[model samples]
Target: MQIEGSVAFVTGANRGLGRAFVQALQSRGATKVYAGVRNPDRLTLSGVVPMRFDLTEPASIAAAAQHCRDVTLLINNAALGKVNVGALDTAFIDLSREMFETNFYGTVRSCQAFAPAIVGNRPSAIMNVLSDATWFARPMVSAYSATKSAAWSYTNALRVELRETDTQVVGLHVGFIDTDMARDIDAVKSSPDFVAHVALDGLARGDEEVLADEQSRLVKRTLSTEDGYYLDPPPLV
Candidate 1:
């Protein structure tokens, strides 16, 4: 779990939290980083190599796997959301399939392709980026919530499956961050750099999960609360 001299592959590294992850890894003394993105030409990391990948594409994932076979640390960070948001909106429902394709299966496929490499480099780590919404449903972004929840389930299942392997699986759950993705939201957001630091630190310390913010901790605590929790449904148009 030591970051020093480690080789890492981070998807969606063009911007947002993914970029922060790359920076954090490098700052922690990572020897190499394959910064995966849909468009690698735009990537500007000095010490990091730009890796072309579209998580939704099997061919791309395979190629990335082949290229980054030496990776010891893997970060599943790529995701997609609808171009627009609204209540009972046809746009969201219409894009539900697309959203799940990237948010859920995309991560799943990436994991499948990279797991062997991680196993080869026993005692490595895989950090799955999740969300506080995995614990509580949210309206407007109901589709995204569903996909994140599926990822949360997958992370738990993978943790059990990889229990005997050298690969350490860590799930990262956090509230909204001040990323381009959440730019429209008015809620208080954590910085991507802070989230990345906490996540990597947790992994090195062998923590099972990284609760990146107060909101994430609050939501996770409620999962076992005796009192029933309430969540509102998606708003109707």
Candidate 2:
């Protein structure tokens, strides 16, 4: 779980939180970092190597896993986040499936492909970027929340499954991040750098789940309450 001298592969590392994760790894003294993105040409980051990885494509993920076989830290930061899309709308099923493809299935695929390597590496870590939405329902971005919820479930299961190994699985849950994905939202958002640092620190300390922000911590704390956030959720739209 130590960041120093580690080898990492971060999905969706072109911009936003993914980019932040790559930069954070570099600053934390990771020996090597692979920035996984669909188009390698778009990766202008200085320190990390650009990797051709498309989450929706099984072959692309397999190739990246093969290439980055030495990766000790796998950060599942790539996700399809769609806002202002109603869950019951006509385009609901299509968009929902697309999000599921990348956010749920893609994440699981990446984990499966790299798990063997991670187990071999030992003292490694897998950080799954989740959201506070995993604990609550927002009608505006219901599908996105659904995908995060599924990821959160998978992360927990993966953690339990890897309990005996030296490979630590940490789930990072946070509120809106100050990235392009939440640009149109009118609310205070956590900077990507801050969230990335929090996640890295959590991994260093061997935390199973990281609530990176106040909103995430509060939401998680109240999940067991009778009148939890999910009971009467915000009209995010």
Candidate 3:
């Protein structure tokens, strides 16, 4: 799908990679971008319209879908992580639940709510910002990784389900990005602007999957190891 003049709804657009997505789409000549955020006031982006949305709330998702009826592309960019690393510990179970609720259930809700909008526009698309952790385990972010893995699986199923409709579903997998989310992590991170550029280009070119950085490419190449190296479960201890 051509992004120029296409309407897009990007969640978590108040900052970080989400903010970059808004700018990237605008730079590509998107007609209108609905920057969805839980706290709309935090978004002061001049060219985009701010739409109030808390992804974990089904009603809020529906409201945003209704509010952005012209949206041809839905970008699932929001995620939740724990304050501490050991999410497998009983003490962090609540955070684990919240992570899944926000990262997995919330994504599904957004997809359902926006399907009509995308279908109405016909031949539109959905871009899910997944992570390389979907394949490789990140011990410190075990719970967060689990959530993204679920999203990765769901995106695969969704791609097949939407094939007949010609509504492109692009799954984007990237390593750590130079955003607040990866600020303290030592991993080499890509700039959010670069990730957005590659992702949008992949979406327009009808690419089923986009590995945005070298780390993501490495993970994909290693996924077929005989020992299932890339699929290892996060260490609990």
Give the better candidate number (1 or 2) by lDDT.
2
The TM-score-based order of candidates, best leading, equals: 2, 3, 1
Clashing pairs in 2: none
Q: Would you list the C-alpha lDDT of every candidate in the order shown?
A: 0.86, 0.92, 0.87
User: Against the correct fold, how does model 1 do in TM-score?
Assistant: 0.93
Model 2, TM vs. native: 0.97
In model 1, the worst 10-residue window by lDDT is 228-237
- Give the clash count for each candidate: 1, 0, 0
Pairwise TM-score winner, candidates 1 and 3: 3
Candidate 3 pairs with clashing backbones = none
lDDT of 2 at 1: 81
The sequence of per-residue lDDT tens digits that candidate 1 reaches over residues 76-155 is 98887544454476777667788889989998999999999998987898889998877765556778887899999999
Ranked by TM-score, the better of candidates 1 and 2 is 2
Error at 5, model 1, angstroms: 1.5
Q: Please give the lDDT score for candidate 3.
A: 0.87
lDDT of 3 by residue, 1-237 (tens): 899989999999988899999999999999999999998887788888999999789999999998788989999999875544554566567777888899999999999999988988967999999998888665677777788999999999999999899899999999889999877677678999999999999999999899999878877887777766576643433
**Candidate 3: which stretches are off by over 4 Å?**
83-88, 227-237
